[model samples]
Target: MKVLIPSFYLILFLLISNCSTNETVIEDVTEIESVYFPTVDGTNWETKSINSLNWNESQLQPLLDYLEEKNTKGFIVLHDGKIVIENYFNNHDIESNWYWASAGKTLTTAISGIAQHENLININNKVSDYLGTGWTSASIEKEQLITCENLLSMTTGLDDSIGDSVLPENLQYVTDAGERWAYHNVYVKMQDVITQASNQSWSNYFNTKLRDRIGMTGAWIPFSDLSVYWSNTRSMARFGLLMSANGKWETSQIIPENFINEATSTSQDINRAYGYLWWLNGKNTYHLPQSQLEFNGELIPNAPSDMFAALGKNDQKTYIVPSKKLVIVRMGEAADNSNFALSTFDNDLWEKINLLID
Candidate 1:
């Protein structure tokens, strides 16, 4: 089915173009920055530019070599805002675009924050007001109560689930606004909310605020090979930087602090570790294993928590650990749900660093 690009979305692109009209050219390009991931279990940190973030490029040297040995696809790390580790096995590169899968939900949700800041939409505002006629509300819950806030928290009580491969649009209004914890496709389809509310195409909204602003330079391809959105392997690391910095990019506040708090912090009481569309470690479902697991096994139940992440199927990830002042990213085939391919890699990477930095 073809998605009808909303006129509101068109206006946003025009606005972006207009900003560049007088003296700038808006081009869709990508960049990969180096990052350093040091571990001390402490927040105090500093940045020093170097050719590489030479900590544990080889800590799991055998493991990395092994994955490549299998012709695996992608992996990249951003430590302390510098690229510490990166490589492609079979299908990967700076321009190699891949699906964020469920990770796309975090990104799309982030753009909603941008839309709010731009005054194109309001998180507290009801969806019915903006969606016009095509919108439908079946729940007894007043459409007025169906604010963008409800959608972000995954409390809309619809049948949305990450485990399920597909969802219908009706999930948006299946019950009272905040009665359940089902992950709904309505969150994604709420692009209609974004579209109707912000009056912008999801792509344009992402390109303008997220991709273009922070230099994600990746395509948001939900469908169409190379079509959902495209970017290189390292392009994802930039997103980890955005969350770690709390929406500020090089000093500018790309997203409001409140939005970041709401998005990364679990909004629904039902899932204490879910925020917006991102998964947090403090939640029960995020327990880490040890020995080969050997991680600190800490959870961030509230703000200032150590680790928050945008995780997706097949084990794609952009992890933000504020306490360590680190952002790590991994893209790969789902090896096991118990420990995504990056689990041991994450633990070993930290353990190796703790040996030096701590």
Candidate 2:
């Protein structure tokens, strides 16, 4: 009986030790499963296989086929900051550079945030403070009311009907700033604000503050009066990943987390699905560009509710879904006949993505 008692105690000790060991192992694995960040100096990026993710591998081919059919040039899906699906079609390859069109506006948003964090600029300050008076053709009294935040939120109250030009003459006042939301080119002027505040060229400041920091290779090319940004698909993905990480690149807080949260959230009441130059999904209603009409519905019905995107003309998209830990980049020609940022293609594309990820 004495021998049996000692054996039973030994068995209990072994069981407790094994359980404790397993608990420690689980904690270690969780810590190791952190989001991956690609090296800033090289072309090397880690990839994860669909089978390893235990995703609906069968749905992947269909998604690729659909993208190709829709004139897609490049498509990428990053899960936990690691590439899960990367493809190029229609004569496009990994090295190809494409214009970001309106999606580039988000770059301005991020730069503005960084500038504000550096105390170089204040978004709440009147636009005239940076650009000086008469920057807009509005009466000085009305123009004085336009703040940098107004531009970021598309509440500039500038007449967008003057066309997509930010010249002083084109920036006519329509109403008091913050009284309405109109997606206009006036937001581009924020770049000038940044340049003037930082006392450096826009490109130089952007490169030093953001591009180089995140290892993104892109140039802001002046197209007519508009400044358009262009970069390779992976660079766009990197920016998206940085945003998904809440403005962090590895350990560096390239942009303030509070600013990122504010930028992704609804910045104004007129457009529930619009942020600071970013488009949000899962809102109860949304407003589109060039139109004041309010459409009642989620921005993209099939996409995850937490998804916010940088959508550009000709279908340039960088969709960040925090809940799913995904940053999806799609750069290509228009998926359909629509030339606007939001189109029928978004819903249809999400339909396919839903199948693979669900």
Best by lDDT: 2
Q: Please report, as a residue range, the 10-residue window in candidate 1 with the lowest summed lDDT.
A: 286-295
lDDT of 2 by residue, 196-309 (tens): 999999999999999999889979998989889999999999999999999999999999999999999999999999999999999999999889999999999999999999
TM-score for all predictions? 0.69, 0.92
Per-residue lDDT, model 1, residue 93, is: 66
Model 1 global lDDT (CA atoms, 0 to 1): 0.60
Give the residue spans of candidate 2 off by over 4 A. 1-32
C-alpha local distance difference test of each model: 0.60, 0.91
Task: List, residue by residue over 1-358, the lDDT tens digit for candidate 1.
Answer: 3344567885686687777746544343444353433222223224443234344334456656655653347776556676555667775665677766666677777778888888887777776667643343354354456667777776654444333332333434545777666655566645766766656676776787777776665666545221244465656777777777777776578878788887877676665656787777755543221111222433433323457777665566677777766766666665444342234444443444344333
Candidate 1, number of clashes: 29
Clashing pairs in 2: none
lDDT of 2: 0.91
> 185, model 2: CA deviation in Å?
0.8
Candidate 2 accuracy as TM-score:
0.92
Query: With candidate 1 superimposed using the best TM-score fit, by how many Å does residue 328's alpha carbon deviate from the native?
Result: 1.1
